[model samples]
Target: MTVPPDDPAIRAQGLVRSFGPVQAVRGVSLEVRRGEIFGLVGPDGAGKTTIMRMLAGVLRPDAGEIDLGGIDVVAEPERARAELSYMPQRFGLYEDLTVGENIFFYGELFRVPHAQRRARSGQLLEAAGLAPFRRRLAGQLSGGMKQKLGLVCALIHTPRVLLLDEPTTGVDPVSRREFWAILYDLRDSGVTILLSTAYMDEAERCSRLALLHAGLVRTCDTPSGLKRAMAGALVAVVAGDPRAVHAALAGAPGVLGRLLMGDRVHVRVDDSDRRVPELRALLAGRGIADAAFTAIEPGIEDVFVALLGPEEAA
Candidate 1:
C-alpha cells in the first residue's frame, strides 16, 4: 500500500482495548504527520504501552481502525509492519550478541539485501557514536549505549515510522540529551516518530502531545498550546514545609488545583489577582508565616495535573 506523500504516516480512530474485564484504552484516536515527533504523555497505567502495542500491530485491538501510511494495520498487519518499527520499553536485545552482530541479525530478519545492510549499519553505528564499539558484547554496553544500539537495530531496515515506548526512562540526563539529538536527526530526515514518555521535559520536546488519563485522552495539542489552554493561573508557594503548605491550601476557596514540586507548591486558582493575598492570610492564620507566593507560568505537567484531577494525579 502506498499513501500519498502528504498523508499521515500513522492514524488510529476509536481505539478500544481490554484485558478481560479491565479496559486499558477507550476511544483513543491520533493522527501523526509525516516527519514530525508526536508524543503520548501520561502516568503509569494510563495505557501508553497498550496503545503503542496496538499501533505497532503487535497486539490486536478489540475495536479500532488503524492505518499506517496507506495500509490498514488491523486488516493487513504484515504489510503495515513493513513500514513501521516499534521499540517497546523492553526492547529485545540479545545479551551475548555483539553490537554489530545484533544489527546484522535484525537486518537479516528484515531481509535487507547484504550490501544495503552493511552500508546502513555503518551509517547508523557512526551516527549513534557506536562505530568504535561495534565489536563490544551487548551485555557489556552501558545502559545508555544499550538503548542507542536498540535504536540502531530498530532502524536497520529504514522503516517510515518509529514507535518508541519510554525510551529514556532510566537513562542519565546527558545520554538522554544525546538520544534525543539522534531522534531530532531522524525527524529532520523525514521519519515520523510516535513516542510515549513520562518525563514532562521530553513531552515539551515533542511537536504535539496527547495527554492520557485512565484509558482516555484528556487532551491533545502542542506543548505551548496545552499550556495556554490551562484554565486558571498557577501560583508557586514556597514555605518551610511543602506538604504543610499543600494541606493548608486544600479545598481553599477559588483554588482550582495544587501540585507539590520539590520545595514549592503550585496552586492553580480561579484568579491569581485575588487569591494570592487571600491564600497568604489563610496560611498566616494557620501559623504558617514567611510563605512567599509568586505567580508562575503553567507547565505541561501542570496542565496534566489539572486535567487528571486530584484523585488521578495521585
Candidate 2:
C-alpha cells in the first residue's frame, strides 16, 4: 500500500532536542510516506541519532510534534511505538539466548499472541537466512548474523514503520548488501522505513534523503533531486600533483570550489563550457600539461560539498 498524499506515515514538525548546553536537533521537520525508504544522511554528530531517538519515543522533544501513522508520538509514545519498530546501531540482544528464544522474548514483549508469534518468527528467520541457526546462541553469531537477528526481533510485531540508526555501519560489504536487500523486501511489503546512515552509497539506495549537518538540515530531497539542485557544473581532474592543481584552482575565477579524491580533484565551476579551457591552460602554465580532464555526473558527495561548503562526505 502506497502512502496517501494527504497523510504521511511519519511526521515530525519543528522538532527540537538538547543535551544540557548542546542542541542536538534544532527545529527539524520531515515526513515519510508509507512504503518509502526515507534516509537521514549525515556525518557523525549531525544529530541523526538524536532525531531518531525522538522519533522512536526514547527521547522527549523539548518542543514540536511527532506523529506516527496519525498517532501523537510525542504525547502518547507507547501508543505510537506499538505501530513502529526501532533497531538501533547496537540492538539489545540476549547473548546467551538462542535465536528462537530471543525472537520469542521480543514477541512476548510486544504481546504478540503465541500462534502469530510462531508463524511470524518462522517467516522472519527464514527471510533473514537464520532459519538454520535457530538454536544458535546470539553471542556465537557473526556480526552480520547478529544484526540480522536484531532486525528479526525488532520486526516481530510487523509494525507499519521501521526506524533504524546506522544499521549498516561497521558491517562487512557483503553483509551490508544483504541487509539492504532485506530492507527492499520490507519496503515492497509496504513497510515505511526511516533509517539514518553516514555512508553516501547507502544513502543513494533510499527513495529520498534528508542531509543533516551540525543539528541543522542542509537539504532534503531525492538523490537525483539533491544533485540536480546543485548550482554549477562539475569536472574531474586527474593530475600528477593534485596538491599543486588544487592550489592553482583555489579561488580561481569561474570556479566555485574543489575537493580532493585520491589523486584526482573534483572541481565545480559556474560554467565548465567556458572555463575548462582556461583551467587546462592554467594547469599547463604550472608546468603540468598531461592532466586528464573529463566531465562527470555529480555524485552525492559532490553535491554535499557544494551545498555544505565542507568535505565531510564519507
Candidate 3:
C-alpha cells in the first residue's frame, strides 16, 4: 500500500539528542512514507545511529517530536514501539539457541500467540534463508547467517515499520545483495523501512536518501535528484602522478575542487568545456604531458565526497 501523501508512517520534527558534551543529533527533521525504503547515509560519528535509537525508543530524544504511525513516540513509547521493529548494528541474539528456538523466543516476547508464532516463524525462517538451518545453533552460523537470524527475530511480529542501523556492514557482496532483496520484498509487502548505511551503492537502492554530515543533514532527496544537483562538472584526469596533477589544478581558474580516485583524479570545474584543455595544458606545463582528461557525468559518490569534503582533511 502506498503511503498517504499527508500522513507519514514515521515523522520527526526538530529532533535533538545529546551525549554528554556531544550533540549527537542536531535539530533533524524527516518524514518516511509507508512502504518506502528511506536511507540515512553517512560516515561513522555522523549521528545516524543516535537518530535511529531515538526513533526506535531505545533512547529518549533530548528534544522534539517523534511520530510513528500517528503515535507520539517520545510521549508514548510503548505504544509507538508496538508498531515498530529495530535491528541495531549489533543486534543481540542468543548464540547458543537454535534458529527455530531464537525465533520462538522473540515471537513470545512480542506476545505473539503460540499458534501464530509457529506459522510466522516458519515463514520468516524461509524468507531469511534460515529454514534449512532451523536446527543449527545460532553461534555456529556464519556471519551472514547470524545477521539473517537477527533480522528474522526482529521481524517475527511483522511490524509495520522496520528500523535497521547499518545492517549489512561486513557481509559479503552476495549476502548483502540477498539481504537487500529481502528488504525490497518487505517494502513491496507494505513495510516501511528506514535504514542507515555507509555503502553508497546501498543508498542508491533506497527510494529516497538523507545525507548526514557533522550532526546535520547535508541533503535529502532521491539519489538521481541529488546527483543532478551537483554544482560543478566532473572531469576525470588520468596522470602519472595524481598528487602532482591535483596540486597543479588545485588553484586553476574555473576548477572548484579535485579528488584522487586511485590512479585518476576527479576534477570538479565550473565549466568543463572551457577548463579541459586548460587543465591538460597546465599538467603539460608541469612536465606531466602524458596526462589525459575527459569530462564525465557526476555520480552520487562524487557528490557525497564533494559535500563531505576530503575525508583525510575534513
Candidate 4:
C-alpha cells in the first residue's frame, strides 16, 4: 500500500495556462504527497479549476511539466488518467440511471473486472449511504445525494490520486460535514486528494493550503503556519454602526488593518497588547460608546483579508 518514492502522486513545475489574451495560471508549481489532503483556495476565476484540469489530463497547460504517479501527464495522458480520478464542479452523472447503475457504468469504463465492479459498487453504495436508494434515479436525488453519487462514481475504480473541483459547493451544512468525513476516510486509506474550495472552513481542514490570487500563488503553508506568519494581532470591535467604526478606524493611528465580518469589525493592530486602550479612546472621541472589544486569534479568512487588503484600490 505504499506509493513509490519516485512518484509524488501529483507534481507540476512552472505550470501555466492561458485563454487567448488572458493568463489564468502563472508559474504555478505544486506537489501533493501521498495520503494527504491538499487545498487550493481562492475567489471566483482564480485559476484553481484550470490547474486541476491540467493535473487530471483534461486540459493541457500552455507551459510546464505535469507528472501523475510517476507518469508524465502531458506526454502520456492515457496512462496518467488511468491512475487518477477527477470530479469536476458539474459531475457527469446520467439522470436516467439508478445509483447502482451509474456506479457500475463508471467502474466498467475504468475497466474494472465484472466481479470486482459488483463488489466495489456494493461497498461504495453502502459507504455513501445510498444503498437503500440504489434503485432510485439519479435525477430524483437531493443536491447532497447527487454530490455523493458523483463522488462514488469518481472513486469506483479506486484511483491513486483524486482531483476534486469544488465538490461541496451548494451543499447543506450537514451534508458538507458528512462529505468531509468521507474524504478523511479516503485519505486515511492512502489516497492523495487535491481539492479546490471556496469555504474557508473547508480549506482549513487540508494538511496544507495554497492561496491563489490574480493567477499567482500568494502563499502556501499549513493553516497554522500561515496564521502565525500574520504580522499583526486581530481585535474584534462590536459597535452600533460597524460601517462607521470601520471607516473611522481605517487609517487611525496604531491601526494596521480591518475586516468586516457580518456585524462585527475585525481590526488589526501593530500591537494587540497596547492597541485596545488607544482604540477605545479613539472611538470615544468620535461619540461612539458602548463598544465591545476583544482580542482574538486570526483565522484563515482574516489572513486572506490582510493579504488582499480592502477591495477598493488606494
Candidate 5:
C-alpha cells in the first residue's frame, strides 16, 4: 500500500497489553512522523520493549488500534509488518553465518529480488561500515559490529519504518556514537524511526521523546520542551563527598526533589536564590564549607527524575 507522505508513518491509540497477571502497557498512544527519530525513554521494565513489540506487529495489543504506513496493524499484521523492520535487543543473527550470508538470508526472507538484494546489501553494509567485514563470521565480530550487522540485515528490505529496542544497550561508547550516525543518515534519507532506550543521553538525540514510567507515558515532547516543562529550578551541588551533601540537604525546606548525579547532587528547588544560601549554610554547619553549587539546566535524565521522583527513577 502506498502511504500518503503527509500522514504519520506509525500511530498507536490507547494501546493496552498484559501478561497474565502483569499489565505491561496501559493505554499508551503516540505517533511517529515521517523521516524523524521518535524515542521511547524510560528505565528497565518500563514497558519499552512491550510497546516496541506491539508497534512491530509481533505482539498484539489486548485493546487499541495500531496503524503503520496507513495499514491496520491489528487486523492485518503480515501486511503491516512488511512495511517496517524491527530490531529487538537480541536480534536473530545466525552466529555461524557470515555477515554477508545473514543479510542475504534476511533479504530472501523479505522476498526481495536477487539483484535488488545484492544492490541493497552492498549499500546498507557500506552505510553501516560493515562492507569490509561481509565475509567475517557473525560470532567472531565485536559487540558493536554485531549490532551494526543486525541493523544492516533489518534494513535489507528498506522498510518505511524501523523499530529498534535498545539497539545500543551494551555497545561501547564509540560504537554507540557510530550507530547513531547511521540512524541520522537513515532519517535524512526519509526513513521513519521509533526506538526505545534506557540511556537518557540517547533519548536527547531523538527528534521527540515519550517519557514512560510504570506503564504510563508521563510526558511526550521534544527534549528541550520537556526540560522547560520541569516544575522547579535545578541546582547542582558539587562536593567531594556527594553522600554528605545529600545528607545535609535532607529535609531542607523549599527543596522539591533531589537526585545523585555522579559526584554531584542535583537538588530541585522552588527558589534557588533563597535555598542555595540556606543549603550552603546547612552544609557549612556540618563542617563542609568548600562545596560548590551551580544552577544548571536540566538534562533529559533530570527531567525524568523529576517526573518520576528519585525513588522510581532509581
Candidate 6:
C-alpha cells in the first residue's frame, strides 16, 4: 500500500470548458497527491462535476492538459481510464439485480477473472458491512447502502485512483460519516481519492481541499491552512435584536463578512481590537447598548464569505 514518490495521482492544468454560451469551468488547475483524499468543495453549479468528468475521461474539456497515473487523460483517455474508477452522483445500478449480482455484473464488464471477482466481491461486501444484504435487490436498499454498493462495484477492479462527485449529498449524517471512514481506509491502502462536496464540514476532513465558486477556485489548502489564511478576526455579538445589529454593522469599516445566527451576529473584521470600540459606539448610537461581544474562531463558511463576500457564497 505504499505510494510512489514524487508522482501525483492526477493533475489538471488551465482547464477551460463551456456549454451553450455558459462557461462551466474557467482555467481551473489542481493536483492530487498519491494516497491523499483531495476534496473539491463548492456549492451547486460551481463546475465541480465538470472538472471531475474531465479528469475521469467522461467528458472532453474545451482546453486544458490532464494527466492521470502518468497517462495523458485528454490525449490517451482509454489508457488513463484503465487506472481510475469514477462513481458519479447517480450511479447506474440495475434495480432488478441483487447486490451480489450487481457486483458480478460490474466485475464482468471490467474483464475481471471469475475467481478474482468472487474473492473481491466477498472481501468488499464484508468490509462494507453489506455481506448480509447480498441477496437483496439494489433498488430496495437505503440511499447509503446503495452508495456503498456503488463503491464496491467501483473498487472490484482495484483501480489506482478513485473519483467521486458529491458522494455524500442527501445521505443521513451517520451514513456520511461511515462513507468517510471507508474513504480513509481506502486512502490508507494507497488509493488516491478525489471527491467533490458542497458541505463545508466534509471539506474539512480532506487532507487538502480546493474551494470552488462561480467556476473558479477561491482558495486551496488544508482546512487549518485556509482558516489561517483568512485576513481578519471573527467577533460574535450576542444581541436581542440580531437583525438590527447585522444591518448596523453591514457596511462598517474593516468589516469583512457577517452572519446572523439566532440571537447572535458573527462579524469578520480586519482588526477586532481596533474596531470593537468603534463598533460599540456605533451600536450605542443605534440605541443597542445591551449587546455582548466576544471574539471567536473562524469557520470555513466565514472564510468563504470573507474572501468572496456574502453575495457570492450564497
Clash statistics: count for each candidate = 0, 0, 0, 0, 0, 0
> lDDT score of model 1?
0.92
Q: In model 1, how large is the Cα lDDT of residue 83?
A: 87
Worst 10 residues of 3 by lDDT: 305-314
Q: Pick the candidate with the highest TM-score.
A: 5
Question: TM-score of each candidate?
Answer: 0.97, 0.95, 0.94, 0.96, 0.97, 0.93
Ranking by TM-score: 5, 1, 4, 2, 3, 6
Candidate 1 wrongly placed segments (more than 4 Å):
none
For residues 57-92, could you state the per-residue lDDT of candidate 5 as single tens digits?
Answer: 889999999988779998899987678999988856
| Per-residue lDDT of 215 in model 6 | 90
Per-residue CA lDDT of model 6 for 83-143, tens digit only, reads 9999998866887999999999989888889999999899889888899999999999998
Off by over 4 Å in 5: 1-3
| Residue 275 of model 1, lDDT score | 91
Better model by TM-score: candidate 1 vs candidate 5: 5
- lDDT for every model? 0.92, 0.90, 0.88, 0.87, 0.92, 0.89
**Residues 1-314, model 4: lDDT tens digits:** 35576567788999999999999998899988888899998887888999989999999989999977668899888987668999999857999999888987888899998898889778877888888999999999988899999989998898989999999999999888888988999999999999998888898999999988877778889999999998889999998889888888978888878988878999989887788988899899998887899989888888877788757211
Clashing pairs in 2: none
Winner on TM-score between 2 and 4 is 4
lDDT of 6 at 152: 94
Residue 270, model 3, lDDT: 90
RMSD of 2: 2.0
Candidate 6 residue pairs in clash (backbone atoms < 3 Å): none
